[model samples]
Target: MIVGIIGGGQLAQMLAMAGQPLGIRCLFLDPAPDACARTAGELLCGDYGDARLLDELARRATVVTYEFENVPEASLRRLASRVRVHPHPGALALARDRWHEKRLFADLGLSTPPFVAVDTRADLDRALAVTGWPAVLKTRTMGYDGKGQRVLRTPGDVDAAFAALSGTPLILEGFVAFDREVSLVAVRSADGDARFYPLTENVHRNGVLVQSRARPGDPMASRAEGYVGRLLAHLDYVGVLAVEFFQKGDMLLANEMAPRVHNSGHWTLEGAETSQFENHMRAVLGLPLGATHGLAPSGMVNFVGYLPEASAVLAVPGTHLHVYGKAARPGRKLGHATVRAPREGDVLDALARLRMLADAGGAG
Candidate 1:
């Protein structure tokens, strides 16, 4: 079986690696001639909007899937007309726009931070009225890794933010002063079979994920699962879905969702009975779903902007490193390492060491 992947980045590369043992070959269509996923599969280099390239991918793949949420909706529709795109095009479209995504979450009975759409300066004022002070202003589309957003606390801040981010549809969400951030990574099949990894507690810097710890028996796990499961069944979703949330006391407020393999679930590669990449392949292929339980106390640290010496990282007991084959640049996701240990304390100690190395490497 051959799977066609859109956007040949690290996620696609990992997916290809996971599928290899299943005798599933992956072919990637990526605009970047140097896309790292090329090392894992055949790469057809071209813009995602190129019709000829889309046709070729459709002609070759058993089924198609994406690695990111920002894949152009028109391109997705074009592919759907010619081939199967799992997790569905509608899911992609909804996940692309913050307003529509929040609406769907609210409609599905998921609590969300108060939000209002911002299109004009007057609309910004109106939205701020609803959301109050210290809210976040984000472009409704194309925002990721903490880009395309501003924290508005005062009139001057709001004015400067609007001046900088205007001309794009925006969303104003009430700032969440929550205890912590966590995400649920779940996968569902076309047959309705589903498996979920333990909830992940995350730490972020500059809107980029820095670390994640798998919480197998988190007190909030069941609530988080209920919310994400509603999304899976509602979208009739197939493949992996990650929903990030802000936790306050016992409440979990929806932040956003990613429709494909996500940064938070990277720990599953070394920590779970079956890696998220493998299970995503199985779900998209309509094969049996794999177990999502942790192999032990697990955690992960991301290598952003730079990566430390591999020997230093591996020296941390229970640490496994994965480096993306790409040049390091400020704010770029270069790689990650997963840590698994017999006890939570060991996992935490290893992660603390790994993060220090990651921070030092990225510092330069």
Candidate 2:
């Protein structure tokens, strides 16, 4: 089976890696000629709006999915009419806008931070009045990796925050003072068969994921599964869905969700009985879902800006490295390393070793 993927980046690259073992070939449609996923399979370089390219992609592939939600709604709607797209276009559209996404979460009885729309200066004031200071102002569209957002810590920060991100539809989210952040990576099929990976504890720096530790059988795992399951069934969703949460005492507040494979689940690449990438393929292909159990206690460290020496990273016991074939950029995610061990302590030891190497500027 040939699967068509929109956006040719690391996620697509990993998808292709997982699909190849199942005799599934991937073709990517991305505007960037040098997209790293090009090495995974055939690449068709064109803008998302190009009708000719979209027609050709739909014509060639049996199924289609996008690596990211930022793909234009019009493009997805056009393709949905021509080919099968997992998770549905309507789900994609809702996930693309923060306001709609939050409302959906609230409607489903999932806890989310208080939020209000901000379009004009007065709207900002009104939102602040409701959400109060120290809230987060985020653009409704095209924001990722911590970009397109401002943290308003005081009344004095409002005008500056608005000036910095002027003219974009925004959402002001009340600050969440949670103990920690965790996420659930779940997959559902057309048959309504579903399973979830172990909940993962994530640590972020400047809005970018720096590390994630898989907490299999954590007390909060069941709670997260319940919330994510509600979303999957509600969307009649197919393929992998990732939902992030902020935990305070016994409460878990929905942070947001990703419609495709997520950064937090990368540990499953080597730690789970079946990697998230493989299960995503299985779900979309209508095959029976794989086991979601972790092979061991696991931790994953993301390589940002640049990667450490591969040899050094591999030297750590139980560590496996995956480097995305891309040039270095200040905030770009270049690769990640996963460590699995018989015990959480061993996993932490391996993680510390890997972090040391990554922090030493890749020096041996």
Candidate 3:
């Protein structure tokens, strides 16, 4: 089967790698000539909204999927008319807009941090009146890895934040005093077959993912599954969906959702019986889904901005390094390592060492 993927970034690279063993080939549409996924798949090298490129992708591939959520809606509509797109374009619309995502959560009986939509400076002031101080002012769309957002700690900081992010549609969210952040990575087929991987505990430094560990039987897994299941069913989603949550005691406050394979789910590479990438491909292809159970204690550390020598990373016990063939720069996601071991302590030990390596370069 041939799968056409939009946005040939590292996520597309990983998905292509996963599809290789399954006799699945990937065709990518990306504007950058040196898009990192080129090595793993055939890259079309064109703008996302290019009608000719979209037509080429639709003509060649059996199905299509996108890595990033912010793909232009018009492009998806044209492609969907010609070929199938998984997870549905509607899910992407909600994920790209923070306000709609939060409202969906509340409508679905899921908890969310108090938030208000902001279209103007006056709207910001009124939002702050309800959300109060220490709120976050964010552009409603196109924000990722901490970009397009500002944390307003006091009234004095509000004016400057508005000045910085005023040109786009915005959403003002109340600050959440969460205990810890966790994510659920689940897959659902078009036929409604679904599987849930273990909950993942994550750490973010400066809004970029730093590390993630699979918590197979964590007390919160069932609750997270329930919340994500509602979303999967409601959206008629096909393929993988990742929903992040803030755990406050016994509650899980919906943080945000990515309607695609997620960074936090990277541990699944070696941690689960079947990787998220493989399951996503199978789900979209209508193949029977694989088991999502954890095979061992596993964790992953991101190599943001810089990469250490391969020998240094491999020196760590139970570590497997995966580097996207991309030029490194400050705050860029360059690579990652999955730590898997028979014992949870061993996995944790390896992660601590990897964290030190990533931190040394100030990669965050």
Model 1 local distance difference test score: 0.94
Better of 2 and 3 by lDDT: 3
Off by over 4 Å in 1: 362-364
- For candidate 2, lDDT tens digit of each residue in 1-364? 9999999999999999999989999999999999999988989999988889998888998889989999988888888899998878888888899999999999999998899988999998889889876799999988888899999998889889999987889999999878999999999999998899999999888899888999988999988898999999999999999999999999999989999999999999999999999998888878899999999899999888878988889889899999998998877888999999898999999988877766565421
The Cα local distance difference test for each model comes to 0.94, 0.90, 0.94
For each candidate, give its TM-score against the true structure: 0.99, 0.98, 0.99
Model 2 misplaced regions, further than 4 Å? 362-364
Query: How far does residue 297 in candidate 3 sit from its true spot (Å)?
Result: 0.6
Whole-model lDDT, model 2? 0.90
Q: In candidate 2, which residue pairs clash?
A: none
Prediction 1 TM-score vs. true = 0.99
* Clashing residue pairs in candidate 3 (N, C-alpha, C atoms within 3 angstroms): none
Q: Candidate 3's error at 80, in angstroms?
A: 0.4
